[model samples]
Target chain A: MSAAATLIAAALGIAAASVLALVSFPARSVLVVAVNALLGLPPVVIGLVFYLLLSHSGPLGWLDLLFSPAAMVAAQAALAAPIICALVHRSLERSWAEFGPPLRILGASRLRALPVLLGMNRRAIATAILAGFGRCLSEVGAVLMVGGNIAGHTRSLTTSVVLQTSMGNLETALLLGLVLVGVSVAVSAGGIALGGARL
Target chain B: MRKLSLSLAVLLALGGAAQAESIVLASTTSVDNSGLLAKILPVFTKATGIEVKVIAQGTGQALATAAHGDADLVLVHDPDAEAKFIAEGHGILKREIAWNDFLFVGPKSDPAGIAGTHDAVAALAAISSKHAAFVTRGDTSGTDAAEKRLWKKAGINPAGADWYRDIGGGMGAALNAAAAMNAMVFTDRGTWLSFQNKRDLVALVEGDASFINRYDVIQLNPVLHPNVKIEPARKLAEWLAGPDGQREIGAVAQGGEQLFHPDADKVYVPGT
Candidate 1:
């Protein structure tokens, strides 16, 4: 669930960061600060808000996405997107400052320069995706609230660890916790390999 | 992988959430943590072709979810809150499916000497006077509601007392906290029996009539929300109250001890 959800957040974050880099909107600064600030949004609050939105009586209740892996993915994506956006936007904005005026002089539109700038900042974008994936992998509150933590269906590694710890199987819980850390380590190593270790 | 994209598609589709195949049941941690639902839910699903997705939380939270029309049914143990739910027209087709006793467990040393006490009220007063370290669920769970009632009856408030620790967690978490502090607390026998971190906490007071924990099943009202899967919900309620359901519930045991007593045979009706 985390991998798949992180991928969706990556797509969204990359797009948002590219827009923030290429466009010169009046509210760009406010949105940039907002994205950076929202990196700390509590997963539980996101879960609760989504829970209400997907509730049977809520406006989006017709979607019937609550208490499923899909809802959890949505919550995870909401959490990871801001991190990806903030981190990637930092790199994109830096490179855009250096390349923007020259590219515009050469008759390239902001829309056309988007892909060029994104490609130039590949390492930063990759690091941002890794950070986003880490956030998704570690979060428990949001998924627990929205996913319902159904054993086989929506129970992810972190939620299972929590359930085990609360169940008093501290040994098993610790083992699962180690496995979670191991997954993060393995994924981080993979990210460094693919993106280089400049971060 | 299929449910992944399907979930997104449904979200974007903004269409009616497909069919009435599976139902979401809001339940308590005791039911889920005890492994009871893990055993019987699949069986129930097989027999009825209706999958039940359980959201294991406290009774208060579960009731809140059902009140918001988020759950199709509720399998909870707090009768007072269940009564309030029904009175508020949030529930119907209520049935008493099982029973267990909540235990006052503390360090085996019996810090407040509450051991072997049949009167739970007197034991609370004793614990209060002795300033025994007590951990409360404090999360408005079923056990918390019962504990609050017992404190009210004992006419002593331990709210500000340092010996009182409100962990504000589920049954298992509260038990773990109590065990760590050697604090006395109330817990359902199901969770206590299944819990592995006993450390030195033992049942100090039990078998009191006040400690009886009755588990009930209530399906959400379909009239309030036309989209509710009331048919499957009603089927689940009847199954739990029926012979086969009771047998399945009774068959669930841990550590060679039965955790819950199936009491669907003794169903409760209003007034009489």
Candidate 2:
């Protein structure tokens, strides 16, 4: 359940970033920089804001999503958005600069050239999305705060690792930590493969 | 964007509806780690068919969560925090459910040589004087509060001492840190009874009148959160403070040592 939610969050982040990059706004450079800065946003801050927003006394509490898988998804998405946005946007901007004028000289419109640039950089875009996936997989603080770490319900690998380590179950905690590291390494390997893929 | 958000909202609502029969209980990690809830909650669920979704945090966090109306009920051991919560109109019908005691556990070598002492303050003073390593739960928990009280009583400022370390974690974590460092730690008897990784540490100071730990249950005020599952939450609270629940609590013993004594029917006076 946690893995699926993480994937969904990464996908949303990639989609939003791609759309933003395709649009030519006057403040595009500032927006890109802002997104890059947001990449460094701490996970606990995201968790705190979400906890307040989702708490029953908060404004959005009417949605009743506190300590649920949906809240976990929200946290992961918030944490992933900056990474995906900054990486994808940078790649898209660079590719557009390289491919734009040539396509224009060929009498192609900007709208027609957009998909060409995206397709040309699909591998890099995939790499960026997978990098976001790796971040989501390894995150603990945000998810633990929003999901409440309820066993058999909201508990994820990283949260369980924290709980076990704190409870003197070093063996179990180390095993979970190794599993997380293995999964993230696998994801990074896939990203490397995609980056090396022939477009 | 609107379409995506709308679909996500619908999905979350559906998931929430499926859990309509469950109650969200904000509680402390000490209670959860004691293994007492593991024994009692199952029976309550089996008999009542109500699912309990427990969010085990520190006593302070549990009370704060309940105050925010995110929880249907709360169980914690900090009497001052509970009183403040009820006074703020976030809770109602506070019931004293059970009782335990706190003690100092340290290395078997007894570096401070205060083992088997009935004076908690004297033990802490000895530990400070000997410059022995001491792990503190520093997380604003009930046990942490008691530890601070003992330090105040001892009239020593060990905060910056090289021998004192605050781990800012739960009871189990502090115990684990102490085990790893061969340090001394203050913990409630319930978590100590169920803790499996004793390693080289043994209970040092206990049987002190000032070391009593009392637990209480409170339902989130229905007026504050009208949408809370008041009926089931109140039912669970009543069950926890009733004869059956007290019996279950008393029955939970680790290695033939009782972790908590049933005290639901007894009148609890603060600071007694």
lDDT of 2 by residue, A109-166 (tens): 8678767877887877787767677777888999999899887678899999988876
DockQ of each: 0.48, 0.46
- The parts of candidate 1 lying over 4 Å away from their true place are A197-199, B1-20, B266-272
Looking at model 1, residue B240 earns an lDDT score of 88
**Residue A117 C-alpha lDDT in model 1:** 87
* Worst window of 10 by summed lDDT in candidate 1 chain B: B11-20
True contacts kept of each: 0.47, 0.38
> In model 1, what are the clashing residue pairs, if there are any?
none
- Pairs with steric clashes in candidate 2: none
Alpha-carbon lDDT of model 2: 0.83
lDDT digits (tens) for residues A115-188 of candidate 1 = 78888888888889889999999999999988888777678899999899889999999999999999999999
- Provide chain B TM-scores across all predictions: 0.91, 0.92
Worst 10 residues of 2 chain A by lDDT: A1-10
TM-score of every model? 0.94, 0.91
